[model samples]
Target chain A: MQIPSPYDMIAIGGSAGSLPVLAELLEQLPVSIDCTMMIIVHRLKNVPSDLDRLLSLKAPITEPEDKQPVLSRRIYLAPQNYHLLIETDGTFALDYSEPLHYSRPSIDVSFASVAAAYGPRALGILLSGASKDGAAGMQQIIAAGGTGIVQDPASALFDTMPLAALELCPEAQPMSITDMVHFLTELKMSAEHDQ
Target chain B: MIKEISNEELETLVSLIHRQYGYDFSDYARSSLKRRFQRFMGYAYIGGVNELSDRLLQDATFFERMAQFITVNVTEMFRDPLFYKTLKDLVLPRLATYPTIKIWHAGCATGEEVFSMIILLQEAGLLERCRIYATDLNAVSLLKAEKALIPLKCMKDYTQNYLQAGGMEDFSSYYTADDEHAVIHSALRRNIVFFQHNLVTDQVFNEFQLICCRNVFIYFNRQLQDRVLRLFYDSLAPLGYLALGLKESMMFSEESIRFEAVSAVHKIFRRKS
Candidate 1:
């Protein structure tokens, strides 16, 4: 099912074995689409996560600075060891709050903030992961009248996160990478036409 | 996720707080304030935003209870180790030239960073010549910081941070530990004077060669940040150093502000005379 409004903000959660799928989604993003996108992947606290550098082959990605503005047509990676919160003023706030589900940059925390900041215009996508961190965040998005998309559990390498999100938001049917890309492009086109 | 207060209710609550208690939270970042409001509601077992506001309006003591959540933020001994390392390498050497040094640590919540700074000073052989003033708005936090204690379990990580910051000696030697806590050695606590000062409502109290108010600005909006930056500027001695968190900036305020970034990467600035 297609969400009616063009997504003003999008948050994607990934962990375990979701890197390749995340890369594909970012790579296939329509160039004309203009919105803020955040990528949250479960990473170790002290470890060097150059996820942005790895994913920046075609899509230029940045690890946002504290209280940095959330500009359109740019992608952000959740900085390591900091819970990334998007404030309502289209800026980011990073804090060292306690880890949720043993993950410092918990997807749930960001997703909840997105739900609060964007309400119905927020879009959340849950991909492969080994933990249940993003499930409640997806629930929060759905509860706030936002659209949630789950990676097909059958296709996920680690299906735990996708299945967990599906349990909370059954209306968010499993979507394959190609199908998700097609749907996003169509939404971008619709929004552009309306303008 | 808990329900957040509406923007209107949030504004009313902030205004009510300022009017009743004279603690100005009017300029705090609304996003962080909203998050704290949700936490307060959960703590008080109040369901709706109106109910929470009503309870605070009725009970004087409840606002005191709410202050604890608003203040008393988190800190570790050596957050962002590289920032500390830069302090040792670049900042401290110039500070040693003085026969006596005065340093002010604003928003020194629980004094972890104060302890960290003291350790650095002690290593540089400048502790004897230095007088450090550490202040926070929360009385309970000031009392805790005066005790010079930390959780014993956090020592391992802090030790790693110390080593990365080019620690000259063993970090374990600074504290004595039981099963639950590690009390810092009394010798290391000699130079610091901890007190209570509010960044929002307080004015400049003393001039210092170095002033640090790190990571505290993230809780404030741009206007409040500018106000606090001006306070720090007035509190600094001419050509004094002002250190901030990695991403915090002074560029948000007026155009002719008199400080120049000496090390933008480390968030260290110097007053231009």
Candidate 2:
């Protein structure tokens, strides 16, 4: 089946083994893409580093600000020690009250929030990571009538995250990062066609 | 990989809980229950569900412990600050037109969201005209909500959220700090009611202008999400609002087309005419 296009937002979740894969995926995304992107990568809480600087090498990046309006073609990273959630009016919010599975910037929280916000209009992609963090959130995305995509375990740097998501959401499509990017670009094109 | 529990054993456990005890787990999503059971087993130092079941039957303490395990009690105050901020900036103004308002916090765990809503309403000058109903499946969390006492350490984080969500007053003014706990202002609590209500089996008891159920559906399956969404749709008055957790949505449900998105990212929806 041709997946729906014009996704309101794209939510990507990853962890330990995500950097290289994230870099590859970001390189594939065109600067002219017109959808908001929210990325959740598990990280150490107190160790201050610039993910924006890191991601900027591959794509334009922005950190979600409280109540700031979301704009297209910008990559938004979940801040350290906070669960970044998308707001209804197309802005971003941060919650730092507690940690899930001993990790802040949890993939589950971000994926789950986006699943709720965009429903079928949301696209959830799980990349390489350690642990089963994004599994439940992928299930949430599917349960909310959204599409769930995972990097093919065979190609993933660490198969744990994609495997977990596949285990939780059996219908999730498995693709290499290149195929996934092509698929999303085609989706955007098709959505524009229909519109 | 987590050891897979047999379906028969899972069914038997659910049946026993329903027959011997008043609680029902039969309708809960199987995967979620399994994950929680595994976590409970690990936490209680039991080998698996069979041993955990035996302990639950033999020891009341174990049953209580299992209760905590089964319920997804994860929550934080002003969880999606922008959602609350949107309610304050966008929705409350319309709600203020009404002389009186009734809001429900369905699946409210430990009352943080309820208290947060009260604080929002108080700041919006709507508290005097509002009566809030806060319900949750867990009684322990409800009791905590009733006490209105949360750890003082949590105050700093919550205060930050309050400010980020666009608070007009000092965050410290909402509570009084004791040794380790902060007592929420009684004035905010006065118009609030706390009760236990299970979303799976319970029916809507009142019409509401706004109903907030955040992060509670991640523990439920698709059927249950649809069921609960239908319940919320039925519970809402015409043009009323429904807010869900960042991960929860009403897509594919019968009510999906019946409500228009007020804030899609915040999962806020307004009832259609």
Candidate 3:
């Protein structure tokens, strides 16, 4: 039997035109995937967010508390304004520092921290957006020997984000929503076999 | 160069600061500290974490500069309007009865929120009786807070926030401005005692009727949060009020039992009498 994939975390970063894709991804993913799922989507800072409540319809999506445990089998969404950071010590941290790439919870910030924490043991996904925020982040993942994937530019509502990532990480895999669902299924099965 | 920092290197750096400068960052959230250290590296033109730590140990002034960078200072006047309004309507009247109203603004970075609090006290006619002690971990920030010079460009937004916080008078009356900045009127500064106090290592200095430490606990780890909760609980007089950041929860702390929620939505709690 092929060796089961030992991935423990899957980080997804997107901005404009990504929310619908997230909803679809959540609706399709299995009920019991045992990896820490982190999603960072750009949203207004001060406005109250229903994104968690909206996404929770598919699965139990949550916003992490500072120093919250990075337990697996849960979906963690970034809060509105604060940068969500992953700790190498198996926890999460929040920062209210200045915005980068015109964003508080910058894709680059979270992905850099994610890359630092998980290295090759993680998967990074970049989806539809109009900005250049996630490109450097995806490159960080690839440089750390992690798997980098992007939603195929053809399938993205806005191709700029995925295309930018591919430009930086030429070797990153590009997949459609169907392909991503299949990839996640195989990932889940691989984990089941490993355990 | 694209890689973010690791905890091991950061731990060494933090311990080095502790050993040499007596500035303890052991209880702070490591990820936030690591991010700040990375920015400090860029500012100082240092190459890596090992070198950063080496330079800090080798040069005391550089370490001070590094300390300045590590402390997050994203603050604005009346940053959260509703918090102030709620205090004005709900918390202040209860506090006004005290013979000498002692209020502590813990981790009051740049004193914007402290200024807002003072405005509330003034409106309620409690400013004379209130003795406000505003403290921050960074001396540089404390100095800025003492001066109360806010950027002139931000006044429009601050004024809007003041209105939303139920201020009837013109917010501009609070400050006089230059081309670049607005220095808050000196009268408001009369009762405020500014000082440097480290929440991580410092012991409780005084008891107060209200301790406003919003958005500060977000930088602390769970253990440190618990310890600071104990400090706040000890420093608060019986039935004294504690206001925390909207996201902060003291649920797991031993002091949690000692504080009853005054307003869970506002993150206000009162010490058990």
Best by lDDT: 3
For model 1, residues A134-195, the per-residue Cα lDDT tens digits are 99888988888999999999898999999988987787868988888887788777867766
> Can you tell me the DockQ of model 3?
0.51
Error of 3 at A81 (Å): 2.2
Query: Highest DockQ: which candidate?
Result: 3
Per-residue C-alpha lDDT of model 1 across residues B157-220, encoded as one tens digit per residue: 8898888777889898889998989999989898899998989888988889999888788788
- For residues B101-213, what per-residue lDDT tens digits would candidate 3 score against the true structure? 99999999899988988888999999999999999999999999989989898898889878877887999998999999999888988999999999998999999999999
How does model 1 score on DockQ?
0.41
Better of 1 and 2 by lDDT: 1
Q: Candidate 2: which pairs clash?
A: A87-B266, A88-B263, A88-B266, A112-B247, A113-B246, A113-B247
Comparing 2 and 3 on lDDT, the stronger one: 3
What is the overall TM-score of model 1 with all chains considered together? 0.92
Candidate 3 lDDT at B224 equals 90
Output the better candidate (1/3) by TM-score.
1
* TM-score of the first chain alone, every candidate: 0.93, 0.90, 0.94
Order the candidates by TM-score, highest first.
Answer: 1, 3, 2
